[model samples]
Target: MARIELSGIQKRWGKVVGVRDVDIEIADEEFVVFLGPSGCGKTTTMRMIAGLEEPTEGEVIMDGEVMNDIDARDRDVAMVFQGYALYPNMTIYENIRFPLRMREVPKGEQDALVRRAAEMTELTDYLDRKPSALSGGQRQRAALARAIVRQPQVFLMDEPLSNLDAKLRQAMRVQIKHIQRQLKVTTVYVTHDQIEAMTLADRIVIMEGGAIQQIGTPDDIYNDPANTFVAGFIGSPPMNLVEGAIDAGTFTAQGIEVTGLPAALSGNVVLGFRPEDCTVGGNTPHLKGSVFGVEPTGDLTYLTIKVGGQQIEVKADRAFRAELDTEITVTFDPARICLFDAKSGERLR
Candidate 1:
């Protein structure tokens, strides 16, 4: 029943603001992720939630109680850090059981609890091994196991998979999601990886420049970005943005032109569309360009076309191929295109 709410949260270091007016309501047992690039205040927001850093304004409420003054240890939250922060001197069993031991759970009860968490993490066999004896993934699992033993009301994980290799990271993501679902404790995960945010979050809080840009489910964030920054940051190849101006119903840029705009959108504007939304050809609305770069991902081929002076990326089928400097024609789905105010970066529609 750990429903968390961050109300008008802001953090500052004198004149340097770390986070600004961020607000989020996390439903009980829901998984939420704070996602952004480096120095974007994701971790700072998490730290404030954990009570490690004080918010210059607003409240950190859990289950309707304001936790602004509550010490971190007293907040009944478990945190898993990126570093794994395991006790090298202690055996896996001892490390996992440390929290229970600290809280003085009965000796008879400790064994079952410790063994259960270890078994849940698939570390039952390695309980006797010390931290150094385990691999990186195992160590991370050990850290997670330790958190599990706490049975805390909230779970705060800060880039728990960043330390692992790509394969291991994927595995850990599955493991983490599985554990979170099974436990059903309110969880907050912080990471810069958009894929992690997309695949793991029930709702994502996207931040930039110390302020929240948008918050929504993965599909919402992907399909309906709030602004140019979000559209540019959320995708694999990201959304292609070209600075242009809409005169009457027509949009004109260095290398692209689009008409049929909603209303009489005039003045400076930016156009955005996903690589996947644009096709190689065979559509009504088409733009011609030259192939500047082609990337084959085995599953799909990505073609970078120099549309006018702007480089527009178009996702093509795996069979698609084009040589550099070859003339190409790409069609954009007008329904999928986004328009933004060029000066403000806010979505126009």
Candidate 2:
């Protein structure tokens, strides 16, 4: 029943601003992710919500009440940090029980809650093992178990899977999402990894330079970026952007020309298209370019093509092969193309 809201939140450090005008409404049991690069204020916003950092302005509201002056412990929020932060000397069971003990839960009920959390995290068999004896993923699970045992109104996770290996990180991501759903707690997760944000979040809040760039569902953010920053930042190989001029319903760049654009737009504009949206060896080729590089990642091959002065990445079948310097014709759907104002970087339409 926790509906969290940050109204006009601002955080500043003297003359430096950590976050600026952050406003978000997190629905009950919604898994919202704060995503961006390092120093982008995602973590800073999370800290303010947790009451670890004071907001310079605005209110933190939960359900229907203002919680700006409430103590962190009294806010009923549980936080999982980037580091496992497990106790070196304590066994898994005892570590999970620590929060319950501090809150003075009945000793008899503590055992049941600890066991339930352990089972939820698949750590029931590792209860007696000390933190030193556990693997990185196991230790992180222990940390999760501790958080779950408290049954807090909100869950705040700060890059909980960053310490694990690539394979382990993927596994932990699934577990985290599953646990969040099962608990149905209002969760605020902070991470710089775009894939993590896409997979885990019910909605994503993309940030940059202490301000939010955009907020939307995974499909909304990927398929329809609001600006150039989001277009370049949201994709794996990123959207291909070219500086060009539109005249009489045609767009012409250095070595590429696209026709049938909106005739109303005549002047400098930036054109963008996703790597996956472009096609190679199509019936109606729009551009011809020499292959610069090909990267095969087992499932798909990313082909880099050089057209005039700009380079573009095109996703192709894994078995697709092409030699460097070979000329290839590329085509894409006109409906998939995006236009942006060259000066302001805003979407043109």
Candidate 3:
């Protein structure tokens, strides 16, 4: 295993910056995920580390050695592409053995290696079948097996499960996590799916517009986002952001008043809170609003309430699928509310 480090990393295409002045240290045998929306440079950063893309600036260091000058094949890393990219004509055995064959391993060793990989991935029963004969999940496993067979020091995966169905994707997430933990290889994964990042990473790197936004564990990014963008980006149904001004000790939205804001906040600011932080039935309410819609998914209910001309989503455990046009009373817990500068979208105390 090897620790990977990227220092002052920047990538540019002509005048467009794909990533800027980023520094990250990934410990040996740790799984790190790069997460963001599309075109945010998560993929770019992963590719640079994989030796597929040369960074415009910065260094890729591994195990105390600078890796910028090394060839892709010499980097001691394996990559699983987003599309699976299996050779259509090759059988599962052939595909998994391709890398070993490229390096001209003896036939007996290649057979041993391929057998071991197939056994680990549970693809031994279908070793003779080509890619066209395998299910999507099976194909994905084949791709992973190919990477695992190499025993690389680092594993780089670029949205490897993005194409699977919902159920399959969920299953694969657990499978991949289990495999990574068992192998203990340092891994760098890039994906736009927040759930995947949160579920798999030892730590997450949140990025946007070619820049790193925040890097922390799943709980850290979920409970304490660095800014408004991260606050909105990290959660399901997202954190509610209301445009309002703080006056005296209360926050005023439309004509309604919300009390108990932290003392330092004043003037134009945005109040942010997760849906779970708001309560549906409360005695002393912070704001009164109408329930615009309710989505019940058996285990949880999401209510979208109209507050001050904006819709705020609230997550609750009880099934409260109230009608769309119904008026609902809501309350915000001041201590749970996050404050951000309205103009800059920066979080405030």
Candidate 4:
């Protein structure tokens, strides 16, 4: 196993900067995921680490050795592309054994290795079948098995499940995590899907246009995002951000007022609270609003309320039966609120 470090890494194409000044340290045997929206530099960053793309600046280090000018084939890394990329004519056994053969492993050792990988990936029964005969999931497993047989220091995967059907993707996610646990290979996975990142990563690197936005454990990114961009990007329904002013121990936004704010905070601020943090009417509503809509996702519902002309979404337990077009008073726990600078979008407290 090897720890991977990227320091001040950057990539550019002519005048277009693909990734800029990114620094990340991935511990040995850790599964780190690069997550972001499409074209947000996730794939480019993964490729740079895999040596598929050279950095325009900085370094890629493994086990204290700089990887600059190293070819992808000599990087001692195994990669699974999004397309599966299996050889069309090779049998499953041949596909899995191809890497070992390339390095001239003895025939007996290659057989054992291929068999073990197939069994682990549940591809033992399809060993003789060509890629064309295998199902999409099976083909994907073959790609994984190929990577596994190499026993490389790190595994780089670029949205490998993007081509699979929804149910298959879910199943493969679980299977892949299981395989990673058994192998314990340091892995760098890239995907736009937050659910995939949340479920598969030991830590997540959230990125935006050409730069690292935040890097944290799943819970840290989910529950305590560093800024408005991260908070708004990582959640499903997303956090509700209201443009407000802070003064005289109160927050005024969209004409609605929230009282009892800490006296230390003042000036233009953006207030953020998750849907689950806002509660329906009680003794006092920090703000008043009309219910704009109800979105039921079976297990829970989100109520979109218009407070002081600003729209906010609040989570409701599935058991609650609130109707749309109803005016409701609501309150938020002061501790749950996140304040951001209105101009910079940086978290204030």
Candidate 5:
């Protein structure tokens, strides 16, 4: 029943704009992630939805009602911040129970609700310990338990896993996704980490410089990006982009030539392809270069090559072995390539 919609939302501080014309419809129980680099206004948008910050334009609608004027506490939204925010003096159980006490949910039912939340977060055994006695992961679980105790209509998590170590962050990502599914609460999570957005979201909203670049499922964003910014930002090692010209279906750049492209395009263009999509030592190589470096990460080897003074990264088998400065030939499917306007950076078909 909690369907949140932000219509033409804009946030401004005098001459500075924090967010501009953001419009998104989040379905009930949907997990939507706001993803971008720092200072991109992802957090400001979430704050507006939470009623912590007022928008200069547009409306915040929930269940078909305007919520821009509503107080934060009355919005029935639970926020878990980057900082665990657990009270130092309170035991984990008491911290989880604080939200229930504030809402004045019948004291008779508070214990059961707290216990249920604790069990769901796997913090049942640490109930009696204070925040100081818990590990970083456990403290975060305590914060989550507090939010769950309220049974809020929406969950706003702002970089909740940023403070944890890498391994713990991965574990918490699984737990958060599981808990969201279990509760069926419409959730909006904010993070700069693409891996987190790709793993946890049903849909991701990519933002930059107070504007949304694109919004789609992870697969859609990765496989068919809307623009060059998206093509470059969405993938690990990113897509290789080379400036070139297309003439009569032949794409030609310095030290590289690709043919059989769609006949509709002509003139200067930027060609893009994923690192993993390109192969080494193919019969008909699309690109030729010398191996500048090779990085092996146990599971895969990343090879960096210099092509016409531009660096292109390629993902190779983990056992791949090559000496520096060795000549290499790389080939990729022509159909897998992407084209963009060199000037505007907009995708061409």
Candidate 6:
């Protein structure tokens, strides 16, 4: 029963705010991810939950109890940090056993617990090695093994994969997911990587400038973003947005025109559509532009076109080829298109 609740949480350093009033309910055994760019206060929010940073207002509740004043060490939550945070001089065996020893698990039970965690992280063979002898991935695995030994009610991971290379990060992501599923511990992971959040989270909390922008599953965040910022930030190439105006159901801007807009929607607006939702070379296209560039990424060829003097990306078939600076027409699925108010960047519908 490790359900977590954050009610009206805020963090402020003097007059400058780090995080706004954040309210969320995390179900028992649920995996929730906090995702945002640097200085967006994602880390601060995690720290508040871990009892490391005191919230300026509101409560951090674990299960049904308020934990705002509980000492971090006594909170029974295990945190895995980005830097590994392993003891350099200690062997992997000693590192994994440290937590159990601190909590004074009986000496007779410590060896089996250490070996089990080591095996789970595939570090059993390297248990005798000091941190200096292990590669970055191995060291990180040792860090995770250490956390596994704690048997905490919740797992708080702060970009634990950020230190590894791309390939290692991918492998570790699989391992971490497997471990979390096996344990069924309520988890809160923080990262700037959208891919990580999309792959691992049961739900994602997107934050910007110290405030939450949206909270939803990966599909919801990708296919139904709440606003322009979310639409612009999630994808590898992101969604295409054009500044334009709609009047009498016709949306018009320089080098672009789209029709069939709702009669009631008339004003300055930002039209948006995903790169993959667009089909190139349509006769009655919604957008027309000259090809600006072409990126061939093996499976798919990404085409960049100049629309309304703005570069927009289109995901074309890998075999789909277009000459540079050549004209191309694009049509978007109406159900997949998005509209935003020009002033607030909020969704119009």
The lDDT leader among the candidates is: 5
TM-score, model 1 to reference: 0.97
lDDT of 1 by residue, 1-349 (tens): 4999999999999999999999999999999999999899999999999999999999999999999999997888988998999998999999999989888889999999999999999999999999999999999999999999979899999999998999999999999999999999899999999999999999999999999999999999999999998999999899999998888888877657777887678899998989999888665545778899989999999898987767888889999988899887777888998999998899987
TM-score for candidate 4, residues paired by index = 0.95
lDDT of 3 by residue, 1-349 (tens): 9999999999999998999998999999999999999999999998889888998999999999999988887788989999998999899999999988877778788888898888888899999999999999999999999999878899999999998999999988998898899889999999999999999999999999999999999999998888899999988878988889997778888724688767666899888888988888688877678878888888889888887689888886666768777777777776788888899998887
Tens digits of lDDT, candidate 6, 1-349:
3989999999999999999999999999899999999999999999999999999998999989999999898888888998999998899999999999989999999999999999999998999999899999999999999988878988999999999999999999999999999989899999999999999999999999999999999999998899999999899889988889999878887777888877789889999889999898777888888999999999999999997668989999999888998988988887888888999999988
TM-score each candidate: 0.97, 0.96, 0.96, 0.95, 0.97, 0.98
Which stretches of model 3 miss by more than 4 angstroms?
104-107
Model 2, 1-349: lDDT tens digits are: 4999999999998999999999999999999999999999999999888889889999999998999999887888888889988888899999999989988999989999999999999999999999999999999999999999989999999999999999999999999999999999999999999999999999999999999999999899999999998899888988999999999988888766789989999889999999998888887677789999999999999999999888989998889999999999889889999998999988987
Clash pairs for candidate 2? none
| Count of clashing residue pairs in every prediction | 1, 0, 0, 0, 0, 0
**Residue range with the least summed lDDT across 10 consecutive positions in model 5:** 221-230
Deviation of model 5 at 327, angstroms:
1.4
lDDT of 4 by residue, 237-314 (tens): 788888889998788887357777778889999888888887888787776888888877899887888766678888
lDDT of 6 at 287: 83
Instruction: Give Cα-based local distance difference scores for all models.
Output: 0.92, 0.92, 0.89, 0.89, 0.93, 0.92
lDDT score for residue 12 of model 4: 91
